[model samples]
Target chain A: MTDTLIVPTFDEPATEAAGRKLVIICSKGNLDMAYPGLILGAAALGEGIETHLFFTFWGLDMITTSRMENLKFTMLGNTAMHLTQAPKMPIPALMGSIPGMTGVATKMMRKQIADLEIPTVPEMLEQITQMGGHLWACRMSFDMMKLNEADLYEEVEAVISASDFMEISEGAQIIFI
Target chain B: MPTTMIAGRPIDVNDEGFLSSYDQWDEKLGAELAKLIGIDMTEAHWAPIRFLRSDYPARGETATLRRASTVGGFAIKDLFELFPGKPAKKMAYIAGLPKPKGCV
Candidate 1:
């Protein structure tokens, strides 16, 4: 499992063709945080690269059937998030804490994503799984959240431990998002 | 872009071997390109390839998997089996279209 092919360039020759592998550690559940891992994993799979997404910590919410579609985008503690009209000014953390602010932020983000015709979270999971990307739920997170297999997205492969992830991630490029 | 024979005549393709000129694509050349990538070019394979060919003109870019499934009416699961390892790139390559630009 430790043996993996050297990364191939864009113009990979047929004889030396060895499929690459990628593992993404999805550790956050925010709507903004969810996209980075899903996007990268799907991009890798599109290129014929083997891709695995491991959802741990709050990231387990990304795969939770009830939570995935409801992920919120709160600007609190996100220093980089700002309104388009005032890009120079970072929205105050206190402003992000106002009641119903998470809903507004999430709605705005969804509209922007939709304008570009991007798929929603559920759609992304479906497409990724269909394209042969592996989805895994961390056992520790699953237990912490008191979640069951039925509560998670159907595409999730299994609830596994950290050591199990290391085993499968051998020789694969790892991305923590 | 480099000029090279696909089916028989010369067509422009990029460094990664995607067809640069969208109009140069036809079924014969599509079959030939599929052969280069180890695909046998069945009707199932043609579904997505044909979709990409028709889709690229207005979109000006290759269609992503979701678009292929949604707009082209092709199932994502079937696409995986038909094109194997790299459906999006493989489909676009055979369709004589540029690489897909959509992240989703």
Candidate 2:
């Protein structure tokens, strides 16, 4: 039998620490809930940290321009105080016969928010992209909602699957806003 | 009450007694102070005082004038690095100065 002696290496382990990455999951449908993730992500990016905002479910409306104008901040709904007690009127669905009530509401809400010095969602998106933060739309959610790529805001980087998002999320600090 | 402004925002001197502790901040040197702080002389009159008051502990009571200029941008962190202790008092003292505002 040949005896093989195992020797341990004495050098200090040179471990490559992972770079800081933060993932923000935006799920709210209205303007008040939407700005936090965008602002924080952009600020983080400005600080030279990698940031990602993943839009899923109702949050997917954040990137879709066609649906963007229809985001409702209803008094009947549970939304931020700034948007509370606003109109929640329903629109008729007669094959485009009636103008979208939500769109009208969004415009009113946008005006109110602007008057209060709150930035709009599109403005937030512009800031986020300018600061090099990434925006990902959930592929399944987009398909389920029957949304087309043309309907989305210009800054959406990709339509990613949940698994792909998870792969990126594994080592990141994930926050659902 | 010690007070100054940066970027149009008002800042109170941190230590409660410091504003009256020192004589009125010289308004003639305000332009020079603004230049040192790297902010416009007009905009530096309010917020810098409030910010320095709120973040005074990061600056010691007697920080070198060179370190005072960094308070405008990296406001809190730079002050802490320069003063290490009693940053609030130091920042208040600097904010009270008739010297040029930012980095020379």
The whole-model lDDT of each prediction reads 0.82, 0.56
Per-residue lDDT tens digits for candidate 1, residues A1-177, read 112221113435221147467899999999999999988888877777888999999999999999999998888888888788888976678988999998999999999988999889998888888888899999998998889899999889899998999898998889998
List candidate 1 stretches off by more than 4 Å: A1-19
The sequence of per-residue lDDT tens digits that candidate 2 reaches over residues A15-66 is 1123677899998777657767876775555334568899988899988997
User: Model 2, stretches more than 4 Å misplaced?
Assistant: A1-18, A79-109, B1-104
True-structure lDDT of candidate 1: 0.82
Task: State residue A58's C-alpha deviation in candidate 1, in Å.
Answer: 0.3
Tens-place lDDT per residue, model 1, B76-103, is 8888778776677778777888778788
